[model samples]
Target chain A: MTYLIEGRDGPWELVVGLEVHAQVISQSKLFSGASASYGGEPNTHVSLVDAGFPGMLPVINRECVAQAVRTGLGLKARVNLESRFDRKNYFYADLPTGYQISQFTHPIIGEGAIEIELADGSTRMIGITRLHLEQDAGKSMHDQDPARSFIDLNRAGVALMEIVSEPDIRTPEEAGAYLRKLRMILRYLGTCDGNMEEGSMRADVNVSVRKAGEPFRTRCEIKNVNSIRYVMQAIEVEAVRQVEIWEGGGSVDQETRLFDPARSETRSLRSKEDAHDYRYFPDPDLLPLVIEEAWVQDLAAHLPELPDAKCQRFQDEYGIPRYDAGVLVAEQATADFYETVARGRDPRLAANWVIGDFFAALNRTGRTIQDSPISADALGGMLDLITDGTINGKIAKDVFEEMLESGESAAEIVERKGLRQVTDTGAIDAAVQAVLDKNPDKLAEYRSGKDKLFGFFVGQVMKAMAGKGNPALVNEALKKVL
Target chain B: MSLDPATVRRIARLARIGIDESDLPALQRELNGILGWIEQLNEVDIDNVEPMVGTGHAALRMREDVVTDGDAREAVLSNAPDTAGPYYTVPKVVE
Candidate 1:
């Protein structure tokens, strides 16, 4: 990680924070009846409220509030029984209303902590300052034509959970980990899909540099980084740039900047505004949000096991290594798939096949675990065959390739392909005798204590049986003859 | 805070406004008035009150681990400004 603007004369450290915008998973928009589904017609989801037509007042969506509470609980934060919506006054071509309805003084979710894992398998806790809900602004397009600025209102009035974090992160890796852990928790709590690429989730990274133990320095907010790789790069570039500025007897200004993916650099957009600059005032039309303690308690009770807890549980129950469990449980789909295969079969074996051979097949076919050619039950069947000695471990590969090629059950493919492991002792003995009779020189090598030649004899037996001979049976028959 | 000419100019630049130096004093007064009104919130006893992000109080909804996407390129690029046969088009570079 190098400085974007480097001229070193003094020391500086980066003080980073994040304001993550996550879309609420709901059927409708924040204030309107329009559908909140993505990939719809450009503006087909727009409503009168979203368009900011005259005399439109916002009505609180109960589902959206509940989602916020669930998120607060998942983050181990305090849930406010009383919260208010304020008007953050601003003017933009995309914002239909001159002011945006957001939370300023009273955010719904309060202080919390997220445990982020570093690259070296160490963990650190990042502080979550607050989580507030607000309406998303429309997108303004400037590249379409020279004179026209097109505004897409579909996003306007959509609900967003702006999770603000404390300036506790130091390195770019910590920021990336914080984002990943936060996304995992959100998805586990069923609050957000955490799909950054879909514009459903985004982060505004604030980075600055100061002396390591000095009070926090002025920082710049990098707006709307939509991917983990870009977020990390933005922090590194911004931190080094601040360091160089301070080292050069200059000052770091608090401003808003945007990261350019093409050049891998951040550019200034404007000076970052403080809360006072937004001129936030309680909304005159809507009243304070008030939820009963009993309802919030119920939501907390029904919360699913979060990522950290589930990862540990998977390791304990499945007898798999922690790293393997971590990989599987990091994604709910992969975890569920592993559980399906591990239900009755040997848990360790199931994990090995899923993570090893199964993942390889998925990678080869350019498909995800969810789209793999072998279903959990089909793979489970293959494992059962291995455990029952119906097919040896070596033969399972053949069955796996056949399953991918023919899309048939492992057992059916094994039967049709005659891949059954040959366990007949008399047949194996006769095959070994015939091979040994013809290859007398090889037999003499085995008798002379050249035991490595035994593998050659076993290979000949498997070939005599056209590669279907049970390896265990072949080993036993070769031992008897020797 | 007195609205210094330079500070006012900086604010104007941030808000994407073009303001003459002479009008800085008046604009500063107007902004202060608004900020003063907002200052009223500081008096509210909200030290223990929980901040609410949105109006709805429903829990987050989640779907099963499923992939509901197929990356339909035509469907996504249908709304782009300029596309060249399944790809977004941009200005020529290195000309």
Candidate 2:
């Protein structure tokens, strides 16, 4: 079903596309030899070229270019061999140069698609328009002074991959899923860190709403939405704003706007500036970028397994359900941890424990897969105890809790706590007899066809054995005694 | 395209260049003259020609990614016209 906002006229569908600026993972700036690392002293990363000193020139960084190609390949996009850098002329205090060097006419990557799986288990492909390389501007700290602002040139000229998407999204959930999938692919490729909080990845959302089956309308660009949650909220509020305007006999203006998450409203930043305003011209200081076809092939050959392929393989190899595989492969670290625990073990049981108890523990402790108290080897050790019948499933949960608390192996916790499974038939039969003696009235009612009391008898028997009896053996002994 | 005096003023304002109102006519004339020269290039009828973006060699020269040119804060701020502590201060920006 399509998401729609009801207006005076009728239902209006939202059309959203995102342009994500991902900082390329490179050691140096795009054209200058300055440091590109985040959070350094304000002016410590500056160089003559980045600061736009007189007679300074730009030299392209090979690693940044390689990273762009790597990202393009990861997105399943077509990479153009020859791409040009153009000067986007603008004036700002943070822009030391009067222009920004970016790809305008010939972008590096062409059309691609990303498959996004929604919460309802339905999937859709969002088209990627293009991916181009550009330089980032410096920061203007207005809060640093009461009467004056301060300039921080730390991020000047850092390489950025601007991934533009086609306006194919009809719902906010689809938009969120697209951003998440794109971020995952970028992280998997190691081309970007995808840290929105650190400003490593940010999105400019283009949103419009129209009556169903109508042509595209004037879309407003929501600038610098740093989080997926904010992007979804911005789309909702902006689409509703457009619907109201259209229904109230007004036209939605084409312009740039800012999403104030605190207020949950989008305010116009600037009226529409056409492409001619930028006056983009080819940069004279640098030549056209060209890469070898063989080099692209080589990079593709060495690419790591992506999330989609890993998810499918997990299902096929581990015999787990699609949902379980998806949960496991959402993050590379989680997938690696799961694989280590599932190797040569009962995969279904491992999946259940990891997805159920392990995930809950991580959430409760505010820990990530990297810092989980239980290691993969330790979890696998606990699973081995269950597989070898040393401990029943009920006792295994207790041992797991003990392992989490004491940072000890599952076997050591079981031994220290004496929680091993009582697999001896004689012991299980004795526990069953004791339960029957204590609950004679209920046992008689159960024997007279009170089938619902069967579960109660099992619980009583297990309690009498201190939850150490193997459940399967206790069930068998109870049937024999009855 | 011919630009009027008002358009010239708007362009100058967008560029953050403070220009006197009296200079608008002259600025408009100068900009139109430059645009006229660029318009002359449209006379060519080479429909099959590929647009050229670079001269000499078409391939860009790439350098290895390294951080060998930073931590010279004194030298970097030496050329600034105004400074406060480690930052370059400017007139307050409201936005």
Candidates' TM-scores?
A: 0.82, 0.97
Give the runs in model 2 whose Cα sits over 4 Å from its true position: A271-276, B37-47
**Whole-model lDDT per candidate:** 0.80, 0.92
**Candidate No. with top lDDT:** 2
lDDT of 1 by residue, A369-449 (tens): 768878988889889999999898878988888888888998898888788888888888989999989899888878998
Which one wins on DockQ? 2
Q: What does DockQ give for each predicted structure?
A: 0.07, 0.76
Q: Give the per-residue lDDT digits (tens) of candidate 2, residues A351-401.
A: 999999999999988999999999999999999999999999999989988
Residue lDDT tens for model 2, B1-95 = 89988788888877878999888888888999999999998898979989776578879989999987978888888999998888888888754
